[model samples]
Target chain A: MEGNVKLITDDGLRLDGRSSNEMRPIKLQTGVIEKADGSAYIEWGANKVVVAVYVREAYPKHAQNMDRAIVKARYSMAGFSVEERKRPGPDRRTMEISKVISEALSSAIILEKLPRAEVDVFIEVLQADAGTRIASLTASSVAIADAGVPMRDLVVGCTAGKAGGKIVLDLSKDEDNYGEADIPMAILPRTGKVVLLQIDGDVSPEEFDEATSMIVNAMKDISKIQRDALMKTYSIEGGE
Target chain B: MKYLETKEIVYPGDRIEINDLRPRNGIYEDDSQYFSEYFGVIQKSEKFIDIAPFNSPYLPRVNDKVIGKIMDIGPTMWTVDINSPYYSLLHINDTPWHVNAGDLTRYLAAGDFIYARISVSNEIKESWVSMRDTGMRKLEKGQVILVKPPKVPRVIGKGGNMINLIKSETDTKIIVGQNGFIWIDGEPDNVNIAINAIKMVEREAHTVGLTDRMGEYFKKLKGGN
Candidate 1:
């Protein structure tokens, strides 16, 4: 699977004609859902994801933490989102993504300030691309901030991988399927702290360093887009 | 440290550089650096720097006046929903009426609204609302509307000017809860006017000269009516 298909053409551009260090276009919008405390919608390349954040009293009478709030992130995909129809429920893969996303967000939110409460983040993927997980997490952070939940910083992420014997910034569908290695990374942009990092497939130590550095730099642009989306929603005319 | 301009929109994690001013609500300090914790507007005064969030859940504080709706009844207490994440408890002893245990419904039944003050709010977010304070009692014959809790102060205005104007102009009685629940009572038409005015305030709460704009708005409304 490593070199069966040509991901990078003779011109040194990937299947989408993007350079190795170039990312797909991403569009972010905040305050999209009126009923939700905070909401965001994102279109990253071909993947479309919507996220909502709800702050409520922790329920079940037992899951309540006396000292801080809990973060519960649910990642769900629509049946038609994939090339093959995905079953409409939380499968094992979805559950794993949900857990990682929840933990990653908990590190950024100031949950201690909201004692005995819970912040629920719902991520719905309307269209599936290769990097849905990172895109969903990015939108969830924006939604949480829009809900006005206190946080240390917004979480932003990107993916880099080795495809066609070349290190690439973002993985396309074909590259993800046939690529040699993939690494998804998320970080707190303010402090450059990595909150979530996962590696799949094989890469040498030097290649791993290059992949992570590429992702870290890409995350800065994503963070700027997140802030601009929030500013668009809350910016007042003549505001200083 | 970078100097942050006051009244500028800021998102969570944006650094706020203030010289010697203490961090207040909507801000947090880490490693001697201040950063905003909410997507809101920055406000700085002589002694403090705070962020006024565009929207946030209601967080109850001790001694704050609030309007609540009775959701469930118990033998000795009633569960009240004060528009916050935590449901407050209103005990029988806290009400003005002399009622015995197990007879709570006779005084304040489920679905009834009350005006009360938060008497106790613990570290765990458990709170108790008391109706023993002055002007605190069962709210009857009024309509309750909710705004974002963070906008309550702007609805009230500096020194209660905005709310007073709305009440006097529309000939209605309005009680603004610090938790964002507002009670408006009067003739149906006047109540509608008051509600509209309050909604306007909620929408433009961040803008300056809102009080003056509201004044002219009311005059035009009255002339048309």
Candidate 2:
């Protein structure tokens, strides 16, 4: 579907008239919702995700028990969010994504520090285009930071897709639909750990290498933006 | 009103491009031209005047007096829904005296009247506020009428004219929430009149001669006072 879009002309310039590999615009805000302990809303390209982190008092749940705190992640999109309406509820696909995200984020948290407590992370995708899961996880990490619960590293969620015979760092809504394969990963920059990994469509091993490197570089920029947003909120050392 | 063109305008939660700065608070600015009546504030820099539109301005700062409600709370912190893009946090640690974060229930309950000051704000707008100071006490004894969030200025009027009228009529304390929840503690009749008055203003917030209609209605309520 994205291939049919006039985003790319014969010259290969994409929609919004950017060259290949350029990402869409992103606008993020932390603690948007008052009710949630930690809340953030991010508009990455066309994908809009609202992430809330609840740092409740420690409680025991068999499935969540670990040496550290349990970071439970839920990723879902609203039914009327997309162009085509989607039915609500945790379908099989969403459950799989949730499991992967929780696994990815658990590596970044100092869970051993929170033995009995459960950190419930909720990610609601108000609008989705191509990279909802990645945006959700990225915003969720910022929400956790906004809540002031300590974490080992900041996570950057990015999707690398093979399109037009090239690996793109951030895929727009249109490119996503037409791209060959979308590899969404949650990367812990410090540890160089890949937490959540999922792919749709086809990619060669060499292309995977290009995509991973592209995603990591892009994530550094994303992390700066996240830190900027948080620093601006708290008016930390360099904020005005 | 005159406009100021600048490089960056500080919005409530974020920043807009430098070129879009108009000195109006309620106006939207974009490239190519300017529209009338949108308010903007001109900040004089070394070489250029920074034009900041009124729409997206900064959140509450420390010692800056603003009103909000107790939306939710943690063991030691109560969240205030300030009339800005970001939420405000009031911590129990910043209180007047020793108060345990775990036992923060009795100090402030949910839905109670709160007028606070921003003690700290983060890039995420994770603000920490304090009610330990004087004049930041709990509100009581009045009927609250909810209005739309953006219509606050209209109901309160420029320089408190609208709210002043209500206070003149009923001698009640009115606490307005940025989230469209207003707490008005007043007599039964005044409360009804005030609610209807807010609804009318919200409907006609953009129309002409609202001052006249509001004055006439208040006169009728006062029997030509």
Candidate 3:
């Protein structure tokens, strides 16, 4: 995809004018929707994702786990989310993302505490640039907390990739398109254990270590924002 | 056991260090790390640590006073929505008087609201409601307002201080359902005042000095109106 295009300037800044260590500005708010048990709206750069958490009776009579709860995550992109209007419904990419997101969420949740119940997380991406999956996963964790489900920890997602032969913390749309290796990872913030990992391009062992370290560092900051958003929603002074 | 600071907001995965600090509702212990399972403020006591969730769904329990709307009238029972996930059954046997099973609407019709008590709830969350000798009756000529169920206890205040104050000052009759439904009946203006006051309580339930704040709020509302 490189055709005499400059992915990085002479000043070591990316095309979006952000340093390799910097990430897009993130804004997270919880309890945005009334009906759902928990809801959050997130704006990370140009990507906008809203997540709603619902707790209901487990269905189909047999999917019910007698000793633990089931988590179902649905990830969808709006028709206008991308440059080309995407058709609605579960595409193959979305189905795969949904499965991974669900698994990542269950990693942090203490599902055994919620016996015979189902925690459903619905993530809708209204606008997308890049890293929409990570943004939605981060917001969905907040929605889970907002829903008051018992959990062991909050899950945080961040992406780091190799651009211009350098590992950057968060990739922009252009960086993602032109980057050699894109790694998206989710972690349990408390334990620092990686729960979800996906690599789009190739990277060496040394590059993988550097990329994961960068994402782990970025996750600490994003996790703080998630906790702050929940606190602000329930704080006495911030109470609505 | 020790406890966290009152009114401190806690999130999932936050560490709690006290060895004897047993976690209670909305708080859980995993290994040696105690964390909050919900997004809520800490409600700590010497006995245990509990977190009051900011917002939660209404789950029916036996002996709970509730306000419900009749959704459908079956042959021998009426299905009522108590703002819970499951529909509560109001049987004819629990009604004030015995009416024939075929024409059940003669006692209570669909879309009608009533104040009742949950008599029984099995393990599966199916609850049966009763109106017999519980001061329960059809709610007529009132405004039904919904708030978060967790805020109900706060609106009631210590020994019902907040609700009683609102009732006396506003000169309104209010029935608070544990399931987050409120029935207010009074002069139009007084009812409006009570409704606003309740909303304020629901919004600022965890804050201190709420009773005094509500008193001033009511005074200002009356003076302004």
Candidate 4:
């Protein structure tokens, strides 16, 4: 509150001039990288992320699952991605993010179909305002589909939280820094199954339910955008 | 049980049906419904429903013709990379001629390319390739190109018509391996023409009227010059 910034203006708009239920604009594109087996680039609000999937030899040979393929994911942030120059390599936060993302994506893929192989997904956050994890997860899901990995469904993720005693969807950087709570969630849009979820700060049971519904509804729209991008890339006519 | 129409593109989680049809490539079944796993065209057979992936990794199967590059020289065998997750072995016994124990490099060095066949393949081990009969031999001259493995069938066309058209039109000899590797041999200009045509086929494999379009394309190329 250095500038005593109001979380919302008197007109009920958030600091970024968005309604409490509004999310930032999102753009998703598949097959952006020519050399990768599958690739996608995403822009959500102020976050920019690119993900590439490689169909390569599975390493740490002993770890390979004989009945199915393993999905290994790595989440990395550029040194200049944030306001301060962060150090390169995996940090504690990125390691945790990578673990959750890999688990979420593993559920979407039909791993049993690909025996003794590995699909490596690398997510690079070039610019991060807030909700980088959700943006990265959304991009990686499209990349995996682009790679032609058989998946049970496409996953979409988003963030929601209580700001100034009011829950909001897709919080921006300012709201995230000063918001009362933050909840990051991901789901299999087709099944409405929550695959990844983490709550930070405080929220009552009623607030939790409201935030969950808000995020899920927003994710449905995001999933459609993801589908359109993929369909356009493959030149498939119309929507499903 | 009714199945989805053929050649209709399906995405992950899109339900094809709840019928008892056997699911094949790019499809998975659940307790209540059958869902598509890949983003590709749907193909239906009498007994099962399958999906032909637009892009996929190569998985070696028995009797598949492959073009490989020698990666390493072992004691009596040479390790070859067949553009797949699994590396194949070319044992000395599979070679057409006898090679003495002293030097195996004379037959195939570490950097040479070869046209071979997957003679033996199983889930538990690396696939073994043979240079025996099946027109398997060292590639002396040409450029190697890769297309999607699933699209290889389309590239060859029905009864090898597409390949024959390209070959006779461009005055080039082309060998299309089942593993999506194409070897072109001819004048550099003609080879380029053939390569471009093969790529166009690969990119538009799902489209209709491809053969006629390709014929017109070759005619145009020949007529323009």
Q: Among these predicted structures, which one has the highest lDDT?
A: 1
After superposing candidate 3 on the true structure, give the runs of residues whose Cα lies further than 4 Å from its correct spot: A1-4, A58-68, A112-116, A235-240, B1-6, B18-21, B99-102, B122-124
DockQ of each: 0.51, 0.02, 0.38, 0.45
TM-scores vs. true structure, each candidate: 0.94, 0.51, 0.90, 0.94
In terms of DockQ, which candidate is strongest?
Answer: 1
**For candidate 2, what is the TM-score?**
0.51
**All candidates: interface RMSD:** 6.1, 17.7, 6.9, 7.2
TM-score of 4: 0.94
- The collision pairs in model 3 are none
Model 1 earns a TM-score of: 0.94
lDDT of 3 by residue, B1-225 (tens): 322123666678777654676777876666756777776777768977787877766778899999999999999999999986557899999989877887899888998999999999866576899999558999999899998888999999999999999999989999999999999999998899899899989978877778988888777777897
Give the i-RMS of model 3 in Å.
Answer: 6.9
What candidate 2 gets wrong by more than 4 Å, as runs, is: A1-8, A57-66, A236-240, B1-225
Cα lDDT tens digits, model 4, B125-214, are 369999997588999889889988888999999999999999999899898988888899999999999999999888778877789879
Give the alpha carbon lDDT tens digit for every residue of B76-152 in model 1: 99999999889999998898989998988888888888999999999888999999989998999989999999999
Cα lDDT for residue B134, model 3? Answer: 56
Error of 3 at B44 (Å): 2.4
How much lDDT does candidate 2 score?
A: 0.66
- How does chain B score by TM in each prediction? 0.95, 0.65, 0.92, 0.92
